[model samples]
Target: MTVYITNAKRTPVGVKDGIFSTIEAAHLAAPVIKTLADCSAVPPDEVILGNVTGPGGNIARLSALLAGLPQSVPGFTVDRQCSSGLEAIRLGAALVASGEAQHVIAGGCESSSTSLRPEKAVFSPQSIGDPEMGIAAEWLAEREEISRKDQDDYAVLSYRRFAESIAAARFTHEIVPVGGCSVDEAALKKRPIERMAPRAKSAFQPGGTVTALNASAFNDAACAVFMTSVEAPGMKVIASAASGADPNFPAASPVPAIEKLLMKTGLSVSDIDVWEINEAFAVKIIYTARKLGIPFEKINPDGGGLALGHPYGASGAMLVLRLFYGMQQRNERFGIAAVGSAGGIGVAMLFERV
Candidate 1:
């Protein structure tokens, strides 16, 4: 009843109103789905996708057809806010493991450019005033005493790591070229972050720590991963779990979520070789890592959402995809990818390289 991911790829993360602005949400996702499906050489039993910003139709179904998948391939679209992509992968793995399907294509896609109401997200009435994400991140930073300097420093490090990776062409392995656009918009926008990050204005507060540089960028992108019951040159899906927390301080949700994952898997934080927690903001990463007592070197060693763009619906898969590459490059034994989503929900999954 185990599931394994055999192939995965993602489109370059595009700026919200930049290069990929005109592309439809489904188009942003279809190429990666097609690439994985064709390259894997197996007719996928299902196409499961996570999407947040798009016209109301089922993006999984739309992308599947656009990718030339047969009509018999049923598709599903899941929405878990920032955790959608990982949620899609988890669902696909569940289907494969439950003897319902043999091969599944799963991930997420988003084009903030095409969506009409991405900015109007809402949460449960229990949430304290149901604050916007940036506002909540700012609140968390203030409450946790996360300094601007600390957040800026983290942002700079992420840029440095991503820049280094770009120079080394490390991401070339996982990117699927779309419309001749092969480079990440975030990478294209990278500058002397040490000089730029500290001066950037706060995203939510008048003088808070959550600056644009310290937080994720709203962008358009898609990421896809193929899962199968058959073994392949990929990682084994170990476990996946989610948890809830105070919605007002939603960024902290991943702390307890990771705790739950480790507990259920019978593994300690120290047992994980690599940690891929979504960098919704520097405060989120800092708080979760501190709460778990994990060393920075073991966490997002390559880079994270701060340096990369955050296509809310697709960011979760981007984290897992990065870990997939990191495991091989670093020879990691076990890896964990976790994300804190809207409404104070957190999703975490365990993976061991196969």
Candidate 2:
């Protein structure tokens, strides 16, 4: 009773202050879900969404309603930061595996444009003690002796790979077009039009290569994958697992999580034909690969969050969809998608062509 991804789609990764800034989170989500429904011909009885920001009343429910699913269909929202989308898929798979539901639409959506900056007024006492994500990455970078140069080089590689993929039209198949106000109205009306060009100057530390040209921008986007136990076509979820690590040292969490997944799947790193590791920061991926003894070439072949942008919640599920599509294109047999979150949470999933 394996749950398989019968269909999947994602909105284009919008650049920060780009065309997607005008779109709301739900507005981005509905289309992806609708596309999945239309393509798969599956009426999802439940929708589980991952979202971090909100005008919240069950963001999943609102997104489902916007997608035109039946009013009776229930929905739930999970917030595991970067791991939210993967958790949504994991939960949906569990429901299918447990016989609680046969059809489910599970994914995540995020509009970094809509996400609020942490203000002292709203920061909880707990948050006051928690390290900010960037600070956490910086700490890990120092601890791992990952020089700023290395981070910049990795970022550059990510963007170069992504730009190459775009030129090759590798992503054309997975991207769902969202007809919106033209780029002029969507981006230019609000800002100087010339600033909207594809490339930008370096914004990272002086002499650092993590420039605007290579890093992913904060943008609005949504992605969804239709899952079912009675799969008609597409890759199946072979196994999935989530693990937690020390919250303060969030960057290293993926290692243990992937270890558990490998053990659970009875497969070694070499057995995996593809690996998608969320690039919360360069150190996270580099460190995880070093710990696992996996080469950088073996991970994120087409780039990752560093290059494509991390919409926080939607990214995890989006990575899964990308891995599935990549494996299909390569005619590969196995793939793995892993994400590390802010609260020291990590999730990993193993997928195989059915």
Candidate 3:
């Protein structure tokens, strides 16, 4: 049994302090579900969502409610950090394959702007040190000998590729228009629709290569991909896998996930037509691609999380959606999408055009 992707779309990547910062996380997700429902003509009863930030009241249920899904419809929220979105799809695929569902929607969303801040350590507890994700990436860069220049170069390639893809209208078919005010309150007060665009200058490191031109800024966006047991004119999931590494070495986590995916699918790097590795940081992507023997040219042809902006939970599903679109445009057969998250978790999924 195969689970087919019927439709998919993602919100435009917004830079931090840019277009999305003003939007609420739940609001960000509503359009994605609405888009899926509108495009696939699927009812709300079949959808499930992945979310990481909101704790008490599951944002997935709230998002569905906000999307005007009937109260009788059931929705589940899942959290696997960065892998949440992809995992949601994995679960949906399994349910369909097992005959539990015929149609479903799975994806994720996040707003770093509203993420709850942890309380400060008052007593300097020895076992309670929780480092921010960026700091972890910095540590990984140092350990992997990945220079700032290399990171910036990779970022440049991502932006250039994304820009080229947009120019080619490669994403026009896949990206549905999100009609709503910008997340920014001020912007919303002025415009009916907020269009997001690339930044003019980089903000990561001054006089460095990781300019705004190639890196994704803090953004507020949502995306969803619809899956069904019914065959459609689209791609399907071949296999999916996730792995956990020692949080002490977060950057190296993706290798094991990719390895497991390859083993499960009995496929090699050469067998894949395209790769979408999340640019959690320059080193993580660079290291994983090099180890997997994936050609840079075949990797992230339409940009990646770094260039498109990482939306925490939504990124994994977004990667898979982009890979499906890429395969469709190229008339390719197979592709892989992977992402690394906090706590050294990683996920990888394989797809095939039917």
Best by TM-score: 1
Error of 1 at 277 (Å): 1.1
Worst ten in a row by lDDT for model 2: 184-193
Q: Give per-residue lDDT, candidate 3, residue 130.
A: 42
Query: Model 2 Cα RMSD, Å?
Result: 4.5
Residue runs of model 2 more than 4 Å from their true location after superposition: 116-129, 181-216
Compose the digit string of candidate 1's lDDT tens values, residues 1-354. 889987789999998888898998899999999999888776799999899877878999999999999999989999998999999999999999999999999999999887888466677684366888888998888898888888888888888888989989999989988878999988877488888986898778787778888998888999989899998878999999999999888899998889999989999989999999898799998888788899988888878888888898898888889878889888888999999988989999999999
Error of 3 at 26 (Å): 1.6
**Of 1 and 3, the candidate ranking higher by lDDT:** 1
Tens-digit lDDT track of model 3 for 1-354: 888987887776555546666667788788878778776565744566666664446788788788887777688888777788888888888888888888888888877766663332222123643455555566666666776667767766776676666557676665544544423222222211112222334344343333343334555567788888888878888888889886755666788998999999888889998988877666777778777777788888887776567776788888888877778888999988887766777788889987
Tens digits of per-residue lDDT for model 2 on 120-154? 22122365346656556666767778765666667
Q: Rank the candidates by TM-score, best first.
A: 1, 2, 3
Each candidate structure's TM-score, on Cα atoms with residue i matched to residue i, is: 0.98, 0.88, 0.85
- TM match of model 2 to true structure: 0.88
Error of 1 at 239 (Å): 0.6
Per-candidate Cα lDDT values, in order, are 0.89, 0.77, 0.71
| Greater-TM-score candidate between 1 and 3 | 1
